[model samples]
Target chain A: MNYTLHEQEFTQQVADLIQQTACILPEDIERALVSARALEASDNVAYSVLDTILKNVDVARKQQQPLCQDTGLPVFYVHYPCGISTRIITRCIQDAVVQATADGFLRPNAVNPLTNKNSGNNLGIMIPCFHFMEWDKPEIQVACMLKGGGSENMSIQYSLPDAKLSAGRDLNGVAVCVIDAVIKAQGNGCAPGIIGVGIGGDRVTGMQSAKKQLFRLLEDENEYPELDKLEKSLLAQLNKLEIGPMGLGGKTTVLGVKIGMVHRIPASYFVSVAYMCWACRREVMSYKL
Target chain B: MNKKIEMKTKHIQLPMNKINTRKLKLGDKVLISGIIVTSRDMAHRWMMEEKSDIIRPYLKDGAIYHCGPIMVRDGEKWICRAAGPTTSIREERYQSNIIQEYGIRCVIGKGGMGKRTAQALRTFSAVYLSAVGGAAVIYANSVQSVKAVYQLDAFGVPEAMWVLQVKDFPAIVTMDANGNSLHEDIEKKSIQNANQNQ
Candidate 1:
């Protein structure tokens, strides 16, 4: 499969994608919020919280403004044809991020860890992180998620078979870890959040898998039966906590829970949880040339 | 725990007096009007160090917002594009001092602060309001104008201090001056629920 990748044209398209991604809350996420609101009593504070969140979504889309003050770090997952050069793709996405920031579609969120200096633009070392994979498809498929710092802070990882949690290297232990993380997070991650769990990989890979699971649609069913059961059970148990919206008491604590698994070595069993706030801004674009 | 209790709504004016702040209770809804000074991690640190006279007037009997708004310039004036509360817990260290020294009556942000800040709220007659997190455009719509800004050049836009005049900006009283915190209550309840589930 041979193709010509036009650099300038691609950059502008990616910029457009970033702008749309920043402003629009995806439908599935919006739907989940509406349903979550229905679960709460009309007089409950949680209902008011969800009502405000839904209204915010509408205003942001109409005004074409960034959904949150912290426009967050732009993360991309690109699937391209075998012949497409990933280097060109990376450069184009980087340029798109800079363009989007200038246009006020995104806030300049990239900061230097060592010196605590912001680049003033959304461009810095590994700022808009990218993951590229070559596939048999002819078109280039790019999906972007704007992950905010508030929820990012809530993301946690745990090594199993611990004495404290009494969580062994089993599914029961995995449930314990996930429950504990949500309890600790409370309303900080912007409750009625979406939970993405990664089990069995090394520490770093485990986190990566958990974040990637966020891309899965809230309504989508897991292919694996055991994992699906765990997802359903955890979702029920978490809502029972009644952390509600913004950690204020109500009914809905999590909108959905997604779990993904990978192969692991005999010695270590790691579980990583990535908590996404209700905003959950993600968009996908397929360019067929 | 009857969930049927009606939540009261109040319209609050900024540069609020201690009497007005003390009347607020947990779970009450608030619509704030008047001027609010925006400060984040950097601006809070700067307030501690400089205590600049320029900002002191705004803080006295006023509200301090934990926000990093996205602002755009149209001609000479600054337009607030998206302004939502950041997590308030980040400011737990500097918040108590800022409230006491500046005579701040209200603290607005999401994710309630720690025990120290709660104690200060009781001592100083201040309430902690939780604005909806990620509701940036809704917040931006309430801003009538940007009166002034500090450290725009040094701190950049998001981290800069924005003094904004607003009308009817909505929030909930998650932590009140009477030493009640919805955050702490919810956390304890959730822990009990977790135990029961296990």
Candidate 2:
């Protein structure tokens, strides 16, 4: 199966996707937030704070405004056909970012890590990062996540069975490590956050899997029953910790939890916890040529 | 303990002094209406080193906010796009000195400061206001106008200091001048919660 697409139209579509993601909360996230708001204790101030956020979400979508100022670096995961030219896709995405930034759909956020200078259009060396995968599907798949800087700071990786945590090298230990990370966040990751857990991988792969889990919808269940149960239990336990919205103490500390697993070497168990603020700015696009 | 009693929010006004700050307690709700300066990591460090005259006059009665906002330029004027609070824990190293030097009465940001910052707030008669993080669009709407922007070339837009006049800016009292810190209490309580859950 093959489809033809115009280069310029494709670029515009990618830009539209980026801008659309920046301006609106994805449906799953919106529903989760609404439900979380409903579940919060009436006395909890986090409920009111979350109300402000919910209203802001409405305004952002109505006014076509970026939900959060951070409008973090645009990270892309592309699923392109084997015969497609990734070079063209990369260039188109880069140009789209610049256009989006100029249009104020994105903040000029990509800065020179060394010089501390902003590119003014969100394009920098290896910025607006792209991860390409060759897929059999003919339609190009594009997904983006506007991960905030504050929550990104909360992302942590741990080597399991640590004596400090009494964590053993098992799934139970992974649960412990992930929960510990959440407790450490103390609402700093912009609570009522979505926790993405990566288990059973080496350090780099562990972090990657953690991030990839963020693309999964909050309403979706993991195919593996064990991992699915882990996500559910973790979500319940974290909320019980009363880390509530902004850590103000309530029943809805986490909107959801997602876990991804990969085979690891016998010597080590690595876990990466990626905390996403409730905004969860993710959108997907497919252009059938 | 009644979480209901804890949930009752008490609003507060800005331009607070030692006495006014003392009246604030942890977990009290506050809605601040006043002028505040936006400054982040690099701006705080720059203030210590360069002693920028631009920020001095504003410091007399103004609070400082920890934020890196999204701003849109319309001709020569600027509009606040999404001016939400950034995490405040990152400024623990410099917050104490900045609070004292600037004669700042309030420090608005998300998350909260540590023991050292709590001590500074106690000594300086200042309070820490925890704004709702990730509610940038809401915050931007609170801004009345952008008075001025400086150091764009040196610190870049997000890191640069912008003098903003705001009205009814919402926040919670997380750090009171009397040395009570809600964030500290939360961390301790959360750890206990984790232990019990395990």
Candidate 3:
């Protein structure tokens, strides 16, 4: 059996990825919006915003246009198979971004933070970082999301003494802290959004887990029932705050709360929260050929 | 069901072709039918640094969308790439000054503006319109024409201002001329509710 990697194949894959982003709103995001609409309290400003958001999704899908204009900084999660060259894959991604930008599928959002210079090709320093995990399978899977800065600004982390602390911890305390962080966000993260919570792990691990957890399908079952229940409860509590859509006052402030947990050292339980805006642009692709 | 109460307020009709910032109101649901220019951080910085009157021609009764659009060129024509509302917070430092200096009346973006901008809105009779944050493509459809482009040749498209002709552009009245802000209202209410629950 022979597996071949070609530049053309790479380019096509990238183009396909970009084009797919144009048409398909990610399944998780679609589910989130539907759930928001269903859970949304009727006849309020939030409901009106949701209605407009739903309409936007419909229009975006039909026109094959990007859901939100801030198409955000392109973040790629690449799972490389054993024996794959990381450098080649990196170059492929960079080339793909340039092609995608040239094709008008992506906005060149990469810029030098200090110099305020635009990276014309959408390729910048340390961008498209590859997190390698060895899988037994020969195939590679790449997941990409245009994580807009609006929502990215809302990510939070807390290091706790133990995993049991959160469970045993004051629900009210937890709620207050979360609400405080969100309110302080001050409509910056684009409300009527989803929150991804990762509990238990080291600081970096917890943060990464929280972000990766965002890729999970909205309808998918959590492996841990306790976590799932907590997520549902948090979702309800968050919406009850009536932060509404765009924080203008409505019942559906949070679309859902997804909690991902892992075993932590008995001494420490780290928690992180990642917020994703209504655009929630993420795509998963398994490459062949 | 909550009562479906509709109250009619004074409606100001500005020709879709042109809009002056001085002619807007608080809580006015405007159907802007005209050409507007878009600029974000890069463009703002450029304008401030250059202090040139490059933006003046585009500002005469024309709206300025606080956006950095994704665009692609087809031969001579530019196609709208993903164009969405950027957070207006970053522009708070520059927006009020830009409005006063450029004679800009209507500014379109998302999230909220700060105290300075709210004051500018009140004093200048300019209005801040909130477009849905992530709905880039839907907002782009309101753009019926791409009239011109500025700067950002080497920096790619996001830094450039693409003058656009828009029709019935939908935006919520966020900051009004009377020193009212929906964002501030929401924040206060949210904190109040949070405190009450506590």
Best by DockQ: 1
Which lDDT tens digits does candidate 3 get at residues A85-107? Answer: 77777788878877877666677
**Tens-place lDDT digits, model 3, residues B30-144:** 5667778888877887777787676688775456787888777777987775667777888888888887787677788888899999998777667888777777777777777
Q: Give model 2's docking category.
A: medium
- Which residue pairs clash within candidate 1? B15-B61
DockQ of each: 0.63, 0.56, 0.55
**Candidate 1: misplaced stretches above 4 Å?**
B1-7
Rank all candidate structures by their DockQ, best first, as comma-separated numbers: 1, 2, 3
Local distance difference test, candidate 1: 0.91
Interface RMSD of each: 2.9, 3.1, 2.7
lDDT by candidate, in order shown: 0.91, 0.86, 0.71
Candidate 3, A275: how far from true, in Å? 1.2
Q: Write the per-residue lDDT of candidate 2 for residues A164-247, one digit (tens) a residue.
A: 988888788988888888888987889889999888788888988999999999989999999999899988898888878888
lDDT of 2 by residue, B57-108 (tens): 8876568999998888999999988888999988889888888887888899
TM-score of chain B of 3: 0.86
TM-scores of chain B, in order = 0.96, 0.91, 0.86
Worst 10 residues of 1 chain A by lDDT: A111-120
lDDT of 1 by residue, A1-289 (tens): 6799888998899999999998999999999899988988877789989989999999999989988878788899999988888988899999999899988899988878776677878888888889888888888999999978899999999998977999998999999999999998998898889999999899989998999999999988898999999999999999999899989888899989999998899998999999999889899998885
Candidate 1: residue A54 lDDT (0-100):
94
